[model samples]
Target chain A: MTPQTDRRLQPRRFLLLTLFLAGALLFGLVAGHEWASPARLARAFANSGGHDMTSQLLVVWRLPRVLAAAMVGALLGVGGAIFQGVFRNPLAEPYLLGASGGAAIGATIALLVPLGLPGGPVLAALSFLGAWGATWLVLGAAGLQGRPDTAGLLLAGVAVAAMLGAVRSFLMLALSDDTVNLQVVLSWTLGGVQTPDAGGLAILALLTAGALAVSLPLARGLDLLGLGDDQAFAFGLDPARFERRAVLVGAAVVAAAVAFGGLVAFVGLIAPHIGRWLIGPRHRALLPASALIGAALVAVCDGVARAALPPAEIPLGLVTALIGGPFFLILLMRRLRA
Target chain B: MIAVDCASVSVGRKGTSLLRDISFRLNGAGFVGVLGPNGAGKSTLLRVLAGLRAPDAGEARWNGLATPRWPARKRAAFCGYLPQQFAPAWDYEAGDIIALGAGRASAGDASPGHVLARFGLTALARRRWSMLSGGERARVMLAATLATSPALVLADEPGASLDVRHKLDLLRRLRSASTSSLVVAVMHDLDLALRFCDRILLLEEGALVADCSPDDLLAGDALDRVFGLRLQKVRRHDDHDWVIGLG
Candidate 1:
């Protein structure tokens, strides 16, 4: 097909794909339970005055978890796109940058610290600071004379993440005698949607939306930035300033996602690749498309996690990596060949 | 007319000089070629002139205003620079690349299509820059530089990877372009510089050894001293005077 014709059809295909994924997720919300038939749902809705167990189960527990998964996934996806743009490396993601590991460190510190603070906001703030700190450290270690060394940055992030992971393990070990639920902490580390309450999910949605607002306006600059720092400067951007802004915004999104949904792996990396395949590399379209794809990916993955192993719930991170890893390899192989 | 004045510009670290005590003044429209041996700081001098580097000792001024002091947007508006290497992170179309070089003037600026057509790159407008041949990519990059429509253009070895025909065509185009803007190009081809450029600057060991007309450059022994080579000069009545190096 002609490039013009291909371009015209891509948006339509993306729209159809989005609609189909939304339909599937909506169906998934009602499909898993044995008692969740259309008639039973209608009856539960009709008799929804007080103590309707099935309705509460469907509306209260499942709905929020699925939506939370989607929001967190969207956060990760957009963050990945920003990281790729700012760092000019296709392999860049918050998880790889130790943002997730940093968030875990922050959350553990918040829980185990003597501040006696409230749960949600304090945890989020700590996680945000932690994510930002870790990213800055990685950038600093990998930067030479104010310019990022891409390979060094990735390697440094990995080394720092490993160190942070060890710290987290130590924190967990130290807290074992303090009556903290090791199971919960383990699940969070392995990455699972904790089924946040409506208020918590609402706060997550707000934070993610706010981060996206700050980032969407930077789309054009990000596109120019992807051409490397020197090239971006020559093309009329202040590369150092723009890079910091993008990296900070992306870290915020990742921190918020980690605070809410734990360290869901690979969504950020894979979703943008999928989005780039659906649309081109222009950040204006790529960001939103990646978000949509990530939302669907997480929702579907959560649904599978719910239904796949029945009562023994598998963590979302395992499922994402299990699926995203091989798929990414295939895509990478294709790209390398091309 | 654009005036580029460099005053004792020196750049490097650890008390070593990559470009040392370089000074020159140019005004009006003309093509000037910078010639030097390897490690003689041709690229460094070009970067200094393009305002991509800050000299340790002195400054470069454009129209009497220090280049580093000019606001980035203002500097970009008046000066267009093309680096020796083009490593774009994205596979942008040739047209989009040029449009980016046009800056925020997308509303009323010269369309990228027009620029591509001018560079004989209309057919490659939709092609991904990474997929293009070396010569085609060079043309696209030069087209982006031209699209900025600056009063001064700084290019580093633009014709390095091009063939004989394309190199000659590129030099001819730059020669014509110099009628409206000052073009400074770093070149290894002394013959091409002599044929197309009005003036030449020869450097040795990070210092300017000669800054004179192309005829004067050929008439002197600076080339032999700087490059350690002898040149055979052929003067013609057709104004196509050329000089080539012999061992």
Candidate 2:
């Protein structure tokens, strides 16, 4: 196709994606409110609920939390899509490169140590450092081996994650005999959107936006990479350099999302595959579609988890795994048969 | 001229070398077939020449300048490489796959449609790669590599899965196109290489056993030594020669 034709098609795709995301967001909002209180929800909408505490709660707490869920979910989804596309492996996810394990270990350390520092900010910072550190270590290992073998990198990630998980378990066992502290650690492990303070959320939004901006240009590069390393290099792409940049950008996006919303799984793994099935493997289409679908899935899941039990909410991660695991298995079976 | 000057090039992972003391200068436009047994380092040599892997000992030079030291993108612009068993993970359309070959071309220059048409892939332009048969996919891949219009094309086992007719068509196309470009292929089909290529490089145990024209390289002694083949060349009615294996 001509460049002009590609450009023309972009607007139509953009419009369709926008409409889909808007509809999903609206559904989540209305459903969340209805679930919060079906009777009060009707009355609140009917009477225009003039600047009451209830309205404030909905606007400030509920809205921001839902938006945060969508934003973080989108980042994970898009990051995962890019990862899968570059690696040419459908099973790859944002955490496959050891970011999540590293971040978890970092967060665990922050909790275990009496750092004399503020809790929320310090924990987030440590998590970011850990994620970055793990990625750098993996890259270093790959470089030292002369060739960045994908299988080797994957094995290294699994090894590091196992080591970190053991350390985290040890820390939890040592520090938390009290139920509340234990619950906090457990809840953190079983992911949730933490309803970040406005300042923190704003910073996260900025970082996420910046990462997306940097990554958007790589859509074409990712497409080239999908052709495999030799072909990509033949097409004038410096695979090693491009891979490093992509990994760093992807890790940063994931780290930012994890910092705000702890340890959400499956959205990253599933969204991209679904997007590829729907939109084909064109990164230009797959990236945005995965982002939208991911956001919608998380928003709907979070809403369901929140309202499923009247007073007791399920962890968002558990809900996602419950839904994603069976579906992932089915997809795997189909792929294998094919 | 599409020249490659290699001087004592060696490549390997650790202590053992895959390709050792390889030195050659290819200075003309012609088809050069590299023939070797399974582990004789034919692919490694191609990779080193294509600048995909680093040479441990010596340099691969293009136009008297070292290829590794040259600007990567610039070097890539002049050389196209096709590795063994190249399969796209995602089902990219034939056109999109070919368009990747037009690297660094402004969005305005040579649409993939034009290249696909040239390679008789116009009808299959929108077809997903996964849907195509192995032969068709090979053609599409060849189209992708050719879309670059590089001075040098290094293809490893380019005709592996192609049928008899398509194999001949590809060889003929490569030979006809060699007036302006150098095509280096690692070929398993000795008869096809003997029929199509100008020069043949025979390798055994990571060393060059023979490097000469096809007429000189395919003699009884060289064939027996390099390929362990006891074969007789017989003339066919269509002004072609065929190698018949003798037990």
Model-by-model lDDT, in order? Answer: 0.79, 0.75
Per model, how many backbone clashes are there?
A: 0, 0
Full-model lDDT, candidate 2? 0.75
Clashes of 2: 0
Candidate 2 lDDT tens digits, A313-336: 778888888888787677657666
lDDT of 1 at A102: 90
DockQ of each: 0.55, 0.58
Worst 10 residues of 1 chain A by lDDT: A1-10
**Model 1: what TM-score?**
0.92
Candidate 1, residues A1-338, lDDT tens digits: the string is 21341355777967865896686567557555242665665565566622777777877777788788888888888988987787776667788789888988888888776577797678888888888888887777777343455557778888989988999999888876646556667888888887888788888788778867887988978888866665666666777787778777887888887877788888888988777766767788788888888888888888777777766677889889898778756755764575
B-chain TM-score for every candidate: 0.94, 0.92
Q: How large is the interface RMSD of each prediction?
A: 1.8, 2.0
